[model samples]
Target: MSLRGPGGERSRWRWLRGLRARLALAISVILVAALGTAFVATYRGTGTQVRNQIDEDLRTDAQLVDSRLPLLRAKPGEIAEAAEEYLDERALFPLSARLFMVRIRGAGNISNLPDLSTAEGDPRLDRDVAGPRRESDESRALRTADLGFSTVRVNDEPLRLYFVQVTRGGRAVAEIGVGESAASVARAQSGVARTFLVAGTVTLLAAIALGFAFATRLSRPLRRMAGTAARVSAGDLSQRIGSTGPQDEVRVLADAFDRMLDRLENAFARQRGFVADASHELRTPLTVIRGQLEVLARQTDVTPDDVRHVDEVVRTEVVRMERLVEDLLLLARADEGELVRPAPLDLAPFVTELFDALTLTADRTFELSDVPPGRLLADEDRIAQVVRNLARNAVEHTGPGGLVRLTVRSLGQGRLEFALEDDGPGIPEEQRDRVFDRFHRTDTARARRTGGAGLGLAIARAIVEAHGGRIYADSSPEGGARVAFALPGFRAAGKRAAKEQAAKS
Candidate 1:
């Protein structure tokens, strides 16, 4: 879990689990498919088009040679020379374009250039072209003027040739063949294929590079978060991932982790502080008991007065220790957020009974001045505890001659305010906020003398809050301390009104 742990190593993957690897692979596949499709279409499409153009040119050139050749005036022997001169003038065929001509001299007699037989090139289309291509090209050309069209290789190179029989007035005066080389068509198509291959390869390489970079940028925060989690789980609650990336989903997750860490750190602080405070509070009473008992144990000539004083001192410490333990237990229960069973009660008489109880227990003047008619939904015991705690606080802080008053007033909307005001000096404004903190006491001398652990208001606050209410402190209208709290009221208006009207009757 530490930084030096194996968590830093990249986990193994099945081909594409890594974001970088998946992205690169996906990009490469998509690009290769698309470009490969385009390349195939271009190569085949261009090849077909070029071959078609070659065939058309062969047909056009054969027609031109047929109409322009002067076979009507040329004598039998002069026809070849005239046909060659005419072919050169029209430039219908390039040097690579081979020409073949045949003239019928007499019955069943055909003649052509003696050199066409000597012209050597494609082994297949060599001198044997006129001899062998004769049966196929001539017979077909005899029936149709521009019918001699065929694609064949000459000397292993592609060539296009056609045979044309020159005529005058529909009667054959001479026969000729014209052809053109088609090697350039194959070359052009091959060049296109090579270009596609090179382009596709370069594109795939570039896609790999870009895909890896994008995946890293996206997964970077997640990697960092995983590492942070490992460290945190290893007991490093202080570890935090600061907001470092753009305001994306990953950044949002990091922010949430930071908030959780803040809570964890605060919780740990409170736990440690609770332990330290408990130890300090318990040590004081234990030390007093130990010291008093030790002294009693050592004194052999102790009088009844000395023994009584020691016994009383030890007993007092034990009583205070018991009270401290009970308060701590209550706070612990409250901290656990335990729910209280709630029931309805009339507020006016509830205040009256607690007021009567306080009058019997304390010397201060106690009054239930104004008990407004209302009902509140609360745990009856817990509410009584809160009232008693506040009442005790008011009595303890004030002298014998000082006054204490308890009042409950309806605030409408299922709420009532209960307050205890004392004639003693009120809590300071700065200390008001922390007054309910556990073990916080302002009057150290009084705490030591009367054994008050300063948990009365804290416990009261806990009980009130658990009942879906709030408790706070402020100055009273009577110029003394006022500890007040609010609870949900369950007073029935109809019942109270009926009782009031009955009393009138």
Candidate 2:
């Protein structure tokens, strides 16, 4: 139910557990929440504004009754008879308003809405609010605060009441109450609620559908990547994918995946080559040993010198086999790509010692240049081995008296480039790129003369890469082979050593 994020944290949404589902749900939640909030705010605001308008109309009706009563008191013998005709002569009120009256001279009353309380004793009105009935024209007006405003109901619908009390000689003569219809306020509020419900439902459905489609589209590249990964796991590294959807993170990821596949394909090819070349190289020596042993077993009078010569030959082949096995083991380990542990080493003396040792092993005109004065961080043995292999490779390819130069120089990017340059026929252009490939040789004749299964350059390349450096072959200025490798320079090594020492402390 929980999805893992890029950082490996469990996702917060429990029900919407997948990444796409959560994305869709999140967008939908925001949309629905926004719509619901707007609906409630607008509905409440509309109800409040309409109710205020209705109250204002009720106030105006009460004021009209007050104006009509004063003239009636001066017009006739009784306030009731003249007020009745005056009420009939005028327009009733707006559809929202109704009229109610009480004669203070006696307990008589009339109302446009019969539901109105009369003489303050009508059963429909609350006894506590209505109080005792008015018995005479001298009935004192109710308290000033309670005189003009009240609440009532008719046919179960709520109403607002505003009363105007009339008096003669400062004694109460009559009272008029104006009630306005609050029913329309309820109806307007209902209409708004219904409209919001319908609109919100439709909008929510649309938002959910769009969110699902958007999530699907965004996840398409990821789904394709997953499929490709499954195929890769099943041993098919040749499958490739690129910028599947939009030019975004997914596209960038697809490009990177393709680069990774390229590397995998090359590594796997090297692995296959390693196995095949090892088998072929080992078979020849074993076959020679077996044939020589068989011939010696049939000899009748083998001399001590002959036996010693046979032993020497067998020993030489055994040593060669041992070296081949060791080199293969090293290459196998390199394939795992573990870190290279480098320490501070002086290149000046290191290169001098290396040249002196290599010249002793091969007959060639060796030129040693002054090594630059700076210590670099390198696995001293591995660096020396890489140089030794290149020198040996140069020795094998060049004729007798051929010149070979061992030089050290700066590469301007905190790198020191050490190269073995030979003054012999250089490698052809087509073979340059494959020079570092395992078991690669320009031709079978050269491979046999060199007595190399074509692993020296491959081993050198692997060691160079392990040091976070690069190795390559090029034509020197003298038109001969230039096999070089560059590692991190001395300045960076000192800084790195200092930081490591500080961390330990």
Candidate 3:
């Protein structure tokens, strides 16, 4: 039961609810999903590739260490010197050494190498080579072990181990073993992971930004169309949305909507014109008929015994029908914007003349008050018709010995007001606005009894509005209904007089 638009009436809901936000969210979700999947795949692939490269490097380093061992063991007594010479001659080798060497005789005898202090280029290698574990069977086996190169955990630290066997005169003499820490391989893998992580983050942020921008661009035209439609629904047919391009659906929709509004505005304009024209055309006939009927009803032709009662009924019906036709004609002219306006006329004198001519019933008293010398530009005949109609309506509603008052005053700033007050039953608040509609009578039974066609107020309103005025019904101070009308004051007499002269011409 929600109301809509400026008038606060219930209306249909529109379709453009958070369209921009929904588009943005949908596009963002899609982009994020796509980017996330790609990032995960690329990151994993890169990590695997980097790890394979690191493993290859580790294996190559191990192989290089293994190839250099034969020459070192050729001179067992001078092994340290041989090792130093080989290390200096090798190219592109990433080998670091923690060495233990052992010598064995043909009869299964083992000899631990002495701390040959004079046999090395560096004293640290010489001292480490002369440690006591060089004589152990396990150390001897490791030196001769033909394991080319392998990664193994030693002392809870990953190490690359390479071993080479040495022999002299066809018998085993000594063996060489070398080991290097695997820390470099781990560092390289970590670098690859960091690079992939950074790349993934950047890709995700860029995707989100692009998604939002695209969504906004797409929804902007739709928003404009929605706004235009809202204005049209609120009775503003002049609004139109800008079209983007013919290739876009929203632009096509906007074009269609504008066309529809054009048709609607034209239809309403025609309807108003028809009503005004029909009302104006009928007024002359009704006036002629009413005048003829009045003349006939006043004739002092025959005796009361010879006069037919039907004649009285016919006169009454003619009056009622004339009033209805006059109301309809006025409404038609007002709707068609064809009502005439004449030169400025003084309101005080007009009100006095209208009251004097109305000839209220003997049972009711007609009173005038608050008369003002306000000048208004209008058609004299139409204004007189409105005043006369209001006065007659007041007389009909007033009770016996009741009061009917006509008031004309200045409402300041070039505005003149007219009010007809009657001491009769006041109209209900809810029915006040509709009282000016054709065929609308407050007391249906009484209207039927009095042969009223219920068109007096409607005609009065049309004449008032045709002169750029407004009329309404309200509560009177005398506990009855007050009907009021107002008109804009006079300007230069040229426009009004010209229009009146044109109508006459």
Candidate 4:
């Protein structure tokens, strides 16, 4: 039975696929490859060196046998016996030497190792050399160049052989063979391999452990961020990665993530507040309209005057609701940065027209300060809305016959400032910043009675901001409130226009 899944994939080892595991595994694999390559190279080099040393020893032994054989004074056929006698008497060969032999007369071979070859043949030895071989010793020695080495198996054991000529009285009498077992070379190479294997195993284990630890440390912050994101997706907006320490890439990402959460939280809070304010404002007007209609419906003898009064009340509430809804829509568009489409507007004529129009809105003493001649890049309709909203706000706050002033001047560097001041109860110092907030009223009761939903200043601020300008409230020199806005990218059409703006300022 197979313990495999689809496509023959292993199901039990899936946990090894995580980023940490993969990173550790990759490091370990590279290390193992490096160490394995080194081991193979070292082992092969060690074997080659040891084998070369064995051949050198055999050459030295052959030289010694060549020097001693001439002094023995043995007959041609007794040459092998005479060499064995010398070896036993003097013990000239090292214990590591596996075989010592000399050629006897009649093309026969002798050695310290027994002749294990049969008449049929010995498979362990070379085919030509196996069996009870009887060939010319000179011919057999000529198989290799003089003083050269070769390997052959003797009695089923491998040995390296060196052949050398032995001469007596300037005549070649016989040849001596020096052999050393290949096992000693094998043993030397094995010792080197064993040492490296133990060292490489320990090094690989330590490296893998360090790789895993480093991977875990590096990925810990990312795992925390993932957890935080999951919690945030579940509507826990307060969740934060809160990464601390050195400013690494992970810490930077965590900080950016926390900042994005902050923005989302604030946006959601504002949306909730906006909805609540809109509901409250709409409910009041709806209640008024409904009450007027219900009173009209319950009348037993509804006169024309009573019906007319109810109609007036209902129409008034409807208009107020309509204006509130329109303002809310404009504010919503402003939030999306789609509130304005800009064009070049002649500031002098525009401001004059604005002042003239606002003068007719209330019974206050309306004054226009000096207007500068210049062209401004603005959306004309949005600019008109901003001015109208500010003028109305000022007019409603000031008493009858109070002085309300409008001022326009060049601020230089391609910018212009407009101020609307009223001689009435001034905005409090602390409330200046919040005056432009939606549905914020200094006098809520009075503002409601006067049909002010308190969105005029807020709408004005949005329009001005969409034109790349800013609006702010300050104390007027006339001892009331001053609301001013500044527009950028104001260009003078000519040198004369520039001079006129400069002089006016």
RMSD of each: 6.6, 8.7, 17.1, 5.6
Q: Which residue pairs come into collision in candidate 4?
A: none
Predicted candidate 4 versus true structure: per-residue lDDT over 1-505, tens digit per residue: 3544553564556548767788878988998899888888888898889898888887777777666664655566466555666667546455345566665443354455445211112233432354444543333433332455877654555567777777766666777776677877678778878988899888888888888888788888888989999998999988888888579887898899999999998988888898999999999999999999899889899999998999999998899999999999999999999999999988889989888988888898999988877789999988888888878878877879988898988777887898889988888889899889988888643545784788998999999988889999998998888999999979877889678666656
lDDT at position 399, candidate 2: 84
Q: After superposition, how far is residue 394 of candidate 4 from its true place, in Å?
A: 0.3
Ranking by TM-score: 4, 1, 2, 3
How many clashes (backbone N, Cα, C below 3 Å) per candidate? 14, 2, 10, 0
Give the candidate number with the greatest TM-score.
4
Per-residue lDDT of 169-237 in model 1, one digit per residue for the tens? 566665555566777788888999889888888888998999999999988887888888899899888
- Tens-place lDDT per residue, model 2, 1-505, is 3444643553444436765788878987898789888988988888888888877887776666666665533422365555565556657544346544544345345454333334333433432234354422111222221556655555577666667777766767766665666777788988999999898888888888888888888878887888998999999999887655677988899889989999999988877877888999898789878988987999999989888988988998898889888888888788887635689887778888888898898778999875666678888988888998898888887888888899887665678889999987888888888989887788843646545778888899999999988888889888998988888755433556545533543
Weakest 10 consecutive residues of candidate 1 by summed lDDT: 107-116
Q: Higher-lDDT candidate among 1 and 3?
A: 1
**In lDDT terms, which candidate is top?**
4
Per-model TM values vs. the true structure = 0.74, 0.72, 0.40, 0.84
Task: Tell how far residue 48 is off in model 1, in angstroms.
Answer: 3.7
- State the displacement of the C-alpha of residue 333, model 1, in Å, after optimal TM-score superposition: 3.2
As for lDDT, the candidate ahead, 1 or 4, is 4
